[model samples]
Target: MASGKEKPLHSLIAGSTAGAVEAFVTYPAEFVKTRSQFGGQKESPFTIIRSTLASKGITGLYSGCTALVVGNAVKAGVRFVSYDHFKSMLADQQGKVSAPRSLLAGLGAGVMEAVFAVTPSETIKTKLIDDAKRPNPQYRGLVHGTISIVRKEGIRGIYRGLFPVVMRQGANSSVRFTTYTTLKQFVQGNARPGQTIPSSVTFGIGAIAGLVTVYTTMPLDVIKTRMQSLEARQLYRNSFHCAYRIFTEEGLFRFWAGTTPRLARLVMSGGIVFTIYEKIIAVIGGRE
Candidate 1:
């Protein structure tokens, strides 16, 4: 068993492993989701994936995966570490966190990850995906592309869509973590003394949490993607304007343009991430 001193570090390792696996496995769905949001919902997810593969080969499906993989790893690590920290702080005398406190802790984790990891990496990933769609792509690769964006627009460019990203992530984690915790507790309650919940049950709980989170936060997800897009400078002024334009110009339904792909990705991602995270935590003998 990991010592109390080692628990947070073990969580970091477990969360990073889970996040990287989820990102790599589900990135194609993410690509389609972003494209649908940015380009509108004209094409089906299948069509988008097929077209991208036909035009750009397998690499097209993985265009901005580098940024996402790295970002997700760091983001998940930070999220788990901060979540544990905040949850511990908010825990009662019995070391149990209430639902509201769990939600708040998750919010804090999400905001911390968004500020430190998600914004910059997602900006780069969105720009790379947008660039790949152009007739003449500007970015050469992940490292070079990041350098180009930073040189051209500085920190602001890398941190584009910060507001929407923060909102989306905060909502996402709060809902997801709270739902998961509640469900896990329910399952644990059903079990006999000292019996741990099964991995399958944990996966199902995570999947349900993901579904709840996606519908609640889809609008913010669309807004965040658009705000981070390369043409965002020319398209709108800020996050508010961007949302306004999306509402007035593209219609209300446009906010859910990529729901299908996002749904697919997040469902699998939730299951995979939670399963792996728990497995690794078990290996390190850390509490969930």
Candidate 2:
């Protein structure tokens, strides 16, 4: 039973380790998503793709990789840790853990993660993802960019897109962790003693969960994107202002300016991350 906490601890470590590697692999898509949010007028896929390949070469795909690696690693760590804690809470509340318990656990983890990471996450993401073409110039690397933002904008500025980040990320994580547990159960239940579940099953579940997460929290994510990019006039005036600023100044419609692209990116990036993370776990567990 000593392995109990040790094993669960591994989930957090595995998730975070997997998050970092996954972020590096999909950085190009992330670069595309961020640039789209901040790129503004003529920020179409074709142009950004061409511009990046032309200016930065293949390495352009990994432009903001360092920040993404750190940010996503921390995010995944917190998410797994929080989920573990919350799952216990739900279990205690109900006197036992179950799939439904996992849902609540996932929900709590999502909300907590969002609350903790909202500002800094958005700030870093914004700073990293900000279009290199923008007239404003900053540092050369992730750390430099983050330090520059804090120095120039203050503590509050470092967490510029706090509001939407919480909403979108919270819901996304809630669904992700919850669905992961549920799917794991389904797989185990159906597996034979000497057999294992198919990778396709895990991938399918992760993809479905990702799609649901993207759609559920899409509007907030869209606002976060614009908020990070300073693409919205109201959101830009006082970057520290809360989401209410968007509601009051531009109306709610303004919050979802770039949801289409954001959703598309989430489908592939988040889905792939979820799928690959589980597959990695299986591989590490000695599954052939």
Candidate 3:
């Protein structure tokens, strides 16, 4: 059993394991989702999947899985660690965490993940996905792509959409954790003391939280994708610039371009990650 002092470490371990599982299961959906948000493409998720499979075979769906899996592991670990730390700091005299405090902790977690993990990972993943659709691809694979970006655009290139990514992630984690915690609390409040909530119920709650997250911050996500997918000094100057351009050129609805595939990926990934994470934490006798 993990003591209070070791709870944070357990969260890190469990979160990483959950992230790896989520990434592996949802990466194909992620590939198509990213492609759909690439600005000019109007293909439905099914059409994109069909064309990609026809042209690049089944392998195309997993174009950037390596970078994404590694990144998500680290991202989830840092997120849970930072969130737990922040939550403890924000707890009231009664040791209760309010919704606003939970939101703040999640915001902190998101910033940490964005700076340390998501930026580089998403940049590499987006580039690889874009390259896969090209006739003559520039980067060979993950390693080559990383090296190419560094050689051409330097370290900054790898963190292409840092600001928007931070914004999106900040809002994502804030809404997700806040909503999930609120829902979980509401469920527990109605249940008998010491009664366990089923894993299926927890998973359902997580899916709802993920849906809230996607809707609340999708515009920023679109801008982040657009900014990261381009060359270092390309069409869009910054997040605001990218948002302006997308709104003007593509119309308002374009901000949610990849909604279908994104919803599928997030709903399933969120449910699986949270359910597995909670189960692992329980097995380790750690505080949730």
lDDT tens readout by residue for model 1, 1-288: 111322788889999999999999999999999888885448888888899999999999999999999999999999889888888888778666778998998999999999999999999999999999888899988999999999999989999999999998999889888888778877777888888778888889989988988999999999999999988999989999999999999899999989999999998888888889888998877764
The Cα local distance difference test for each model comes to 0.89, 0.63, 0.87
**Candidate 3: misplaced stretches above 4 Å?**
1-6
Mark the regions of model 1 whose C-alpha exceeds 4 Å error after superposition.
1-6
Q: How do the predictions measure up, each by TM-score?
A: 0.96, 0.78, 0.96
Cα lDDT of model 3 by residue, 196-237, tens digit: 889999999999998998888888888888898855367887
How does candidate 3 fare on TM-score? 0.96
Candidate 1 similarity to native, TM-score: 0.96
Residue 275, model 1: lDDT of: 89
**What's the distance in Å from true for residue 169, model 2?**
1.5
Error of 2 at 99 (Å): 5.8
Residue 24 displacement in candidate 3 (angstroms): 0.9
The superposed Cα distance between candidate 1 and the true structure at residue 261, in angstroms, equals 0.6
- The count of backbone overlaps in candidate 3 is 0
**Candidate 2 Cα errors over 4 Å, as ranges:** 1-8, 92-100, 115-118, 230-265, 268-288
Candidates 2 and 3 compared: the better one by lDDT is 3
Which should have the higher TM-score, number 1 or number 2?
1
Steric clash count of candidate 1: 0
